[model samples]
Target chain A: MNASDVVTVASSVLLVLGSLLTLIAAIGVTRFPDLLARMHAATKPQVLGLVLMMTGLALSLGDSQLGWKLTLVVLFQLITAPVSAHMVGRAGYRTGKVRSDLLVVDELTEDLRAAREETDREQAGR
Target chain B: MRVSGSRKWLEKIPMVLWLTVLWVLFWGDLSLANVLAGALIGLFVMTVMPMPRIGFEGRVSFIGTAILLGKFAVDVLLASVQVARQALRFGHDPHGAVIRVPLRSHSDLYLTLTAVLCSLVPGSIIVEAHRLSGTLYVHVLDVPAAGGIAKAKADVLAQERRVLYALATDADIAEAGLPPRPWKRGRTDGPDPTTAVGPSGPAGDDQAVTR
Candidate 1:
């Protein structure tokens, strides 16, 4: 009814939504078939869910200092999430954990093959 | 040449301001004393650390930037809903695929930005990036057909065009083989679609779909 009450309701809605999204992300991690798909589940929803939760907390607190702190959390998450995913994906690929069949297109393998051929030709020339 | 030196220092102001704000937030206070201390710490950090020089070779178009941001926000919402649907599906195997996208821009900044943006969206994540060829290997959910692969590549190119419009130099634009203006829809002048390849079928060793 009041302004403060409206803020409270909105914040509460955001918190619930954030929590649900995170729960879905967890379910996705367990349910997804391969490492690549699992990485998708682990990063996407988790980062967005955290952002939503942070935003909700910022709104509820109503303090500018706390708001900026929450913003910092979101910023760092955004920066780090993709980098970490890239690392894990690369590791999985190198370790042969990724299903080659699941890959609809694989340019990396072709590139590697080409490089290997070039080196083989150079060795033969010697 | 005289103003260039001062301009470089001026450019660092935004980074310093951001650092100061971060410091204030870390301390959990907005008092005058905290603000002063934060400023001092920010100055110290800036002096101690040699920050990477950001390429701001092009003019900033505020309207273009706003449009890109708006598009990104909509994409995030839509992609999240789509992923959530797939996530909650009961007793259904996920048909995900990794697709390779050949980008037009060779710039490291562009490649990095594109990867981050794609990963931020729910359905796609960049697994490997080839810097030499400016290609990205993206793992995507539900690529049922060849057309689906095309659609994914198109989405990434569209995002790149938006980014170029917002903050790309003329040289960057030329490198990407785009016109000075925003890329027109259905423009066949861009990179050839044939370069973008998806597997016709399972390559080798088709294992059971593990869930």
Candidate 2:
């Protein structure tokens, strides 16, 4: 097969893989037994899947400029995805939405409780 | 000096550099036009997305997270069939159990994701969560057996493993000192209509599994 044909085949493979991975995450978002588990499935799949799929498309684009733009969009996503996840997670935890019984041990419990107690003590002392 | 929260973005310089490199690779050319454009876009985004002041954990690995996604998919497909069948068969007061699951997650993000995934499945729902105990209370729509006391517990543990199995660092899950889905044979003093001695005694494991 010619170089372009080979590239096309490779890109197709990547696209399929990426699509499948993304579907799993989406299903995970749907089927995971709870919120904590679902989060793992959702964010990671989305960001990585998009990057892979975008990579394939970029290769197929046949233009350095358009490829760069697509790459830029992917780059922007990689940066922002975690930040957005962080924000949502914090809100979920603070709001008491994440289930914790599945956890075997909680490393953050002591520090978080201590800080909360300290804040309450300060308020009471005031 | 009180750390100016504004300067926190400086800490992200490394991430920005990494992102810029990705842009270049994806674009496949280091030509001036692409270079300038990528730089401009990265800088503009960085300037706009204000980082939160947080007692943050360590970095997130895209590769590790991707692996977690694969595991979640397998679990979901399996769970869907389980839930759908339960919904269709033996309709009355389908026994359900709500059990608390806890995990030693590095960040709240991980914890929330776990909860969201579980709730999406047809049978399970997360009703309450406490970050203090890191406890999540979930109500399953179907019980494992008429006397589903065993299934109740198993459901909780099974879901727990599926979720934590994906994201928990090996050390974290192990250190978390979690449990396997041991049948609550003895501790099951609770009402289990699915019990072998119960009216549904002739039921197979599949029927015996649901509440």
Candidate 3:
């Protein structure tokens, strides 16, 4: 096959795969047990799906200007996805919405316990 | 080396170049006029909003960076498949855990990179990062056994080593207590792996029960 034909095949494949991954991510968000797991479903496939979609578009368009713009989209998504996930997870933990049954190890709770005990000791000493 | 005097401007070159490239992309052109305008705008933004200096003391190793990128790409693909399989299966028990991984590197840049990398992968998401102690609280799906906790900590340490080799300075390496060369085969022992005190019961039991 010719180069253009190869590009067309690759782009089509990427678009299909990207959409599928994004669909799975959506299902995961709804189906996952806890907030943390939902966050995993929310961030991972979404970012990768976006990256794949952008890659497909960049390949098919073959325009330098458009390619750079697509790159910009991917870059911004990569930078923001984790930061937003971090914030949501932290918020969920603070609000006690996170399912502790789902978690295997939770050091933050221990830290909080220690802090509370320290405060109690200080008050008793005073 | 301390950034002071005119040399401080040199340090900002990477940011300026990145901003200029972003501007060019936004404008959808790479003409001489666009380039000049983009650079000018970049300079204006940098001067108007001075960023906090988070001492980025690291040198890029081209080969190391390339390897890390390749590994990251592979990890993303593999983890996607794993997560997808778990999501697709019917009545599969979702055993997620939040384990604490103490990092060797104290650098904020390293911690940020580690968190970003972990979150990007499908199974694990960094819930919280303690800046003072350099510990990452990662929520990972499917911890079949307690050994999984150790494996997770090891994976984070391996990632840190790759990042250290790719961009950390000699002093940063020393401060992180890493060898001059990246550790091979997960040989570099990390700090104690702290297990999560998960709420009693399997995650599947709580699947439909919402807070």
Candidate 4:
């Protein structure tokens, strides 16, 4: 086989694997019990899938300019995915979307309680 | 005061150069004309919308950054499979928990980087971050599988330590109460197994039985 044929085969494999990962991530989002859990599904495999697919595309194209663009796509996703996930998780926690009964241990609730009590005590002293 | 003013401008150069490179990349052609246009646009955007200055007091370590990125790629791969398994295991339910981890570093840059890294890693997400206390509240998809609360907390601390080595000054490392990074020694000891166990049970407890 020629060099181009090998590149084509490798790219095809990567593309298939990446798509499978994305499908699993979607399944995870649907099956997961809570908002926070769902966000994990949305961010993790989804980001990795994008990276893999981008790599495949870059290889198949074999153009430096297109490769740079593909690199940008992965870089932007890596930077933004976590920020979006954090925002969603934080919002879910504040809006009572998180199921406390499902959790084994919750230190955030305990710390929030302590903080509130401290504030209340300070106000009472004043 | 004048020296500090120039230093602030110097700090902005990297931001501008990054923007310029992004602009050129988006344009798809690397030429003198494209670079000049990108630089011009980058300058325009910077002046039009100034961002809050994020002080970076530490120098970058090439070895530390390589280690950080290399380990991160591995973590993402392993965790993605783990989460995928949890999803596919039809009869099983993943026990989730929100555990607070107090980080040693107080710098905004380190804290933000740590939080971002933690969230992107598959099984964990940052539900809340208490800036004053330098604590991150992370929600883990499967606590027992992740080795437990103590293990999860240690992972986060380990991440923060890597971040410090990648960017924080030696003085900052000392301030955070961590020993000097052994860059030349490489591949330090693994997490202490005794401390890795959860409070309620031994770390080896089965997934269903633990919770």
Candidate 5:
């Protein structure tokens, strides 16, 4: 297939796959109980879906400039995604909203408990 | 150069070149002025881009954000009519239950957007979103007899995440995937996760959820 045709076909396939993954992820976000669990479902498919769709579009349109813009679009995506997820995770934890059973280890809870105890002792001394 | 991510300036190289090439393509000439202007604009954007860094990563993509807005508009329009009808028929019910549907998204930005989108849907006016807690306390205008409390909350949570996904940076989602998947999407976590403190931390107040 020509590059355009190839990109068109691949993009179509990628978009289909990406859309499916995204739908599943979104479903999990809603259906899955708890904030952490929902977040787990929310982030996975979004990046993949964007990458697939961008690659597809870059291929479909051979406009060198637009393609590069799309590449920039992709680059920005990589940088921002993880940062956002981390924030949500921390917020969930701080709020005690995380699914405790699923968590293998939590350094945060220990730190909080220790800090609270220290405060209690200080208050008692005062 | 201790930060591994900072060194990946090359990762964005393709995008920059792509932009330069785009500038050339758009101008359709190798004029000195065009080249200089394009280079200047490109470099300026690149320098400014990294200045704002949330501890988590971000992957900016306009295509996706646009896609999401399209979906939100449709949902809002449909929901608005439904909510209007309920209000007209039943009058206002102040007794509507307040729910705290927590989401897994970690950022103040995403949570805020999700809250705003939920409130915009007509039936739900988000009363408060404990940013520190990630819990959205939304007042559902009409509580369904069949669904009860859990169902009402579920409906709102599901819709909220759809909006969140629509707005979140694609990079945020992908990096979150680097870790292995947690098993089973079953069972809601309980209210053991309550008790609010300050809405945001000292440094992060600017980005915390507003709605």
Candidate 6:
């Protein structure tokens, strides 16, 4: 009924929702067919879940100082998550971890093929 | 020479301020001593480890940034649910596609930001980014769910447009072959919606695959 009570209830709801999202992300990572798809599960929902969990924590703590630190955590996650995901996806592709069978259309292969041919032609000319 | 040195020093101010802010935030206290200490630490760190300067010539638009951030949040929420549903649905095989989308902007800043934003959204992930050509090879989680290849490419371009609006200059926007600022436009007829999503223009730059 009171303001603090309402804040507590909201934070509790956010905590549960955030946990559920993170759990779904875990399931997606396990169930997705390939590395790239798994990257999606590992990165996307996890980001929103982290943001939600951080917001809930900050709200529950009721300290402006802690809130700023929590904001930094979310900011750092937002900045770094994509970089890590990109690196993993690139590495997976290079290592042939991506399943071509699962992909409906692939354009990168053609581009890579053309690039390699151009280099080969240059080497032949030399 | 002196002017250039001073300008360089001026350029370092923002970095210093940002580092100092981070330092203070880490300590979770705002006092005169903390501020001074943070600044000193910031200056020390920058001097010790210099980073390559990223070029930024765009003017920031508050409204555009608001739209970008607001839509980004919503996209994350909705797409998360979509991906979650895809994962939960039993026996459903999601067919992904690696579609190359040639972005309009040539700048690395916009390219990186667009890549980062696209990666956060569930369905599309940037598998490879060709810096020279400014093309992003995105892997879509579900081709049909994403409304086909053209739709996915357009989504990436749309993300770039929102990014350009937020930070890119009007000249850069025009250079990218996009219409001028929407707020400043007088004409209702923008570039044909078809061309906006159309296959590679007259340039013939995007020639990888067409279906």
* Residues B1-211 of candidate 4: C-alpha lDDT, one tens digit per residue: 1335555565567778998899888877899998898888887887898887665666556667878889899999899889888888887878999999989998888999999998888999999998988989999999988998899999999999999987776678989999876753343355322222222222122211110
Over 4 Å off in model 5, which ranges?
A: A1-5, B1-35, B38-211
Off by over 4 Å in 4: A124-126, B1-5, B184-211
Q: What is the lDDT of residue A80 in candidate 1?
A: 92
- How are the candidates ranked when ordered by TM-score, highest leading? 6, 4, 3, 1, 2, 5
DockQ of each: 0.51, 0.07, 0.60, 0.71, 0.03, 0.74
The C-alpha TM-scores of every prediction are 0.82, 0.42, 0.86, 0.88, 0.41, 0.89
Q: Residue by residue across B4-117, what tens digits does model 3's lDDT show?
A: 566568656778998888888898888899899989998999899978766664555555678789999898888888888777875875788887888998878899998898
Q: Chain A only: give the TM-score of model 2.
A: 0.87
TM-score of chain B of each: 0.73, 0.51, 0.80, 0.84, 0.50, 0.84
Q: Which residue pairs in candidate 4 have backbone atoms (N, alpha carbon, C) closer than 3 angstroms, thus clashing?
A: none
Order the candidate numbers by DockQ, best to worst. 6, 4, 3, 1, 2, 5
Per-residue C-alpha lDDT of model 1 across residues A20-126, encoded as one tens digit per residue: 99999899899988888788778888877897899889889988878877888988998899889889998897788988776666666666679889999999999
What are the per-residue Cα lDDT tens digits for candidate 5 across B1-211? Answer: 1445644553455456666765765666667888778877776777777433333233322344555677665655455444433333423331234455777666776676676556444445454456787776654444562146678677666654454444443335544332211121131243212211112322123332222
* Total clashing pairs for each candidate: 1, 56, 6, 0, 25, 0
Choose 3 or 6, whichever is better by lDDT: 6
Model 4 residue A89 CA deviation (Å) reads 0.6
- Angstrom error of the Cα, residue A25, model 4: value is 1.1
List model 2 lDDT by residue over B4-28, tens digit each: 4544545556557765776677777
Cα lDDT of model 6 overall? 0.84
Candidate 4 differs from the real structure by a C-alpha RMSD in angstroms, to one decimal, of 11.0
Q: Which segments of candidate 3 are over 4 A away from where they belong? A: B1-4, B145-147, B182-211
lDDT of 3 at B24: 87
